[model samples]
Target: MTRTVLVTGGTSGIGRAIAARFAADHAEVFISGRHRDTVEKGAKEIGAHGVVCDATDSQQVAALADRLGKVDVLVNAAGGLPEAGPGGRSALDGLLAQWHASLAQNLLTAVLTTASVQAKLANGSSVISIGSIGAERRGGSYGAAKAALAAWNASLSAEFAPKGVSCNVISAGYIAGTNFFRGQMSEERHGALVEETHNKRPGTVDDIAETAYFLASPGARHITGQTIHVNGGAFTTR
Candidate 1:
């Protein structure tokens, strides 16, 4: 059966990889981005449908839901560090801007998008939210938002488990080949990240994408409300 899948923030990076993964498997895939051109281009390149939507906007999210029927898989991949805090203002104002931006982008994006399409989720569906290693360390505002994401997933899974839906968060660490750092990552920082991993290599988008595929598979049916870390031993549980 061809499952209908939706991947937000799919224009590039991890979301793009996820969309391509499902599309390659002959799934009915749809990807969304805040920009029309990027969304269309990404959909074409990945052989999936594209929709222009800023997940942060309620009206746009609602319209997106109206465009689709029941979705068998929902990947909330829309999230990242915010650009440019309220600079030149008071330090408090800057801090507040960063916090608000972090929450809106990293946490609220997932929350709003999920709530808008909660009714459209098919039975036995899988909802996967992208998280970050920052949550486990000193990620500041961004990290805090991701931590909240994991917390929210626990509750969301409990609510959806009875309906045969599985909800989980993937806490990724130091993934490469994405504009995640927005060109701000220095070579020293990049090297530091790689060295922190036991494997001495940065994580790839495919690493996360494959895990997501497995979570949506029958093998992972029993997995829910868990934060699966894919950081190459950068962070581990005892």
Candidate 2:
């Protein structure tokens, strides 16, 4: 059967890479971005469908689910360390804004999207949410959000596994080719990250993309409620 896949935040970075991988396998893929032009362009290049959506918006997520009807694979890839917004009027307000932004962008986006589309998920379907290495150490607000994501995925997996669906999180580390650093990555910091990895290398978008592909495969049907780390051994779980 030709599967239907939906990947949120597929305009660039890890999301785009995952969408492209599935598209190459000839799946009927749908790629979404917060902007129309970027979504359209990404869809065109990858030979997949495109939709404009901010995954955190309930209405938009609902609308997207209505359009999808039945999704065989759902990848929640809409996340990042949110830019520090304009300073709040007060120190307390600023602190609140930063944490809220992190949770909304990283955690709630997946939570809302999954809830909106839960009914549409086909039997034997898979749900993959992108996570971060920061969740393990020194992540601040962003890391906390990803840790929450993993927790949520665990609960989601338990709920859906009985229905023949699997839910998992891929915790990525120090990927080289994304706008994730917001152009603020210094050479010293970058080198330090690579050195920590047992492989002494930065991860790539395709690394996560391929992992997403596997988790959706029949071989991984028994794997659920788990967080698979993909950081070139930067963080190990034993």
Candidate 3:
């Protein structure tokens, strides 16, 4: 049966690919981004409905939740690198700004959006938040925020598990095809990242999208409060 799926930041990159994957499966997909033009364009391109809402803003998120009815799968894929602040700033101040931006963009976006749509989510619904490998290594402020996201998801899953809802985070590694690098990633850096992966290749948007699809499937109902790492065996805990 077709499910109602909501993907934030679905206008581009991994989020867009996820939306397209669901749309191809004939699911009713609703995508959101901060830009009206990009949102509409992406929706049209993927054959999914689009809405202009910034996941970082609680009010906009509430409006978005209201716009879309009950959602069976909610993918919080709205996050990225922190924006550069004022120049000539002290190291401590720079770090603080980056931390705040990372928390706001990566962690708080999911928190606010999920909270806004909590009531509308159906029982047995799946909540998937996009995370990064940085959370586990030398990711600095960005990684710390993602690590916080995983912690938060654990608590959220426990709270909502009784209601039959499942919550999880996907810790992705070396993923390409997104503005993740903000166009600053050098070819050498990219090559090094690819070389670090076991597959000797960069992760694709479809890889994460397919995993998300499975997590939201009936077979994955028993899975909750877990962090599924999809890094081409680049990093393994087991």
Best by lDDT: 2
Return the clash pairs for model 2, or none: none
Q: Rate the local accuracy (lDDT) of all candidates.
A: 0.93, 0.94, 0.92
Top TM-score prediction, candidate number: 2
Q: How much is the lDDT of residue 224 in candidate 3?
A: 97
**Candidates sorted on TM-score, descending:** 2, 1, 3
lDDT string, candidate 3, 48-85, tens digits: 99999988888899899888778899999999888899
lDDT string for model 1 (1-238, tens) is: 8999999998999999989999999999999999999998999999999999999899999999899998889999998988886457998888888899899989988998888889988778999999999999989999999999999999999999999999999999999889999898999999999999999999999999999999999999999999999999999877
Q: Could you list the CA RMSD of all candidates, in the order they appear?
A: 1.0, 0.8, 1.4
lDDT of 3 at 99: 87
2 or 3, which is superior by TM-score? 2
Badly placed stretches (over 4 Å) of model 3 are 88-91
- TM-score of structure candidate 2: 0.98
Candidate 2 lDDT over residue span 152-235, tens digit each: 999999899999999999999999979999899999999999999999999999999999999999999999999999999999
Whole-model lDDT for model 3 versus the true structure? Answer: 0.92
Off by over 4 Å in 1: 86-88
